[model samples]
Target: MSIQKEDIDHLLNLDKIKADEKNAHIVIDPDQCAACQAKPCLIVCPALLYTLDETGALNFDYAGCLECGTCRTICPHLKKWEYPRHTFGIYYRQG
Candidate 1:
């Protein structure tokens, strides 16, 4: 069966993210992001974690990360990508 937008939204709503304020699982280089012409991470992230501020600087909020690693695969400027330590990350619920 083909999945629709509502289906996807429903699936997303079933998941939860518990952020670890002291440690982040992903890191990106701002300097590299600034020089890059194509910012695929802005569009490709399922969690919508990547964003651009009014000053044109890239901002990433890891709190809601799906741990899907799409940003790591898409962003050339990404400095580090790893699973969140221990008990902090996405919790998928049965839908």
Candidate 2:
């Protein structure tokens, strides 16, 4: 099924979403990741925070991140991708 804003809200509604808006916590080096042909992180992220821009460049939005660390493990470009520090990222109670 296609995910809509309401669907996302419904899913996270029951769970507590503690956002650390002060910091992005997760950072991506598009220059380095650009070399990666197979971007599994784009699909592995449950929150679907990773997306492609109109120019086909990698785009990432951490606003609705679940901080599941899926991107960290799936991405081959380890030189840039990383999870937030302790208690510095989005926390989903059960989302």
Best model per TM-score: 1
Superposition-based RMSD of candidate 2 using all C-alpha atoms, in angstroms: 3.0
lDDT score for candidate 2 against the true structure: 0.71
- Model 2 over residues 1-95: C-alpha lDDT tens digits? 77865676778776655556766767788887687788887778787778888977888877677867788887756554456656665555753
> What does candidate 1's lDDT look like per residue over 1-95, in tens digits?
85454665666897887888999889888889888878888778776677899998888878778888788777766788899988999899887
Model 1 segments more than 4 A misplaced: 1-11
Candidate 2: deviation at residue 53, Å? 0.7
- Pairs of colliding residues, candidate 1: none
The Cα error of candidate 1 at residue 15, in Å, is 1.7
Least accurate 10 contiguous residues by lDDT in model 2:
76-85
- The global Cα lDDT (0 to 1) of model 1 is 0.81
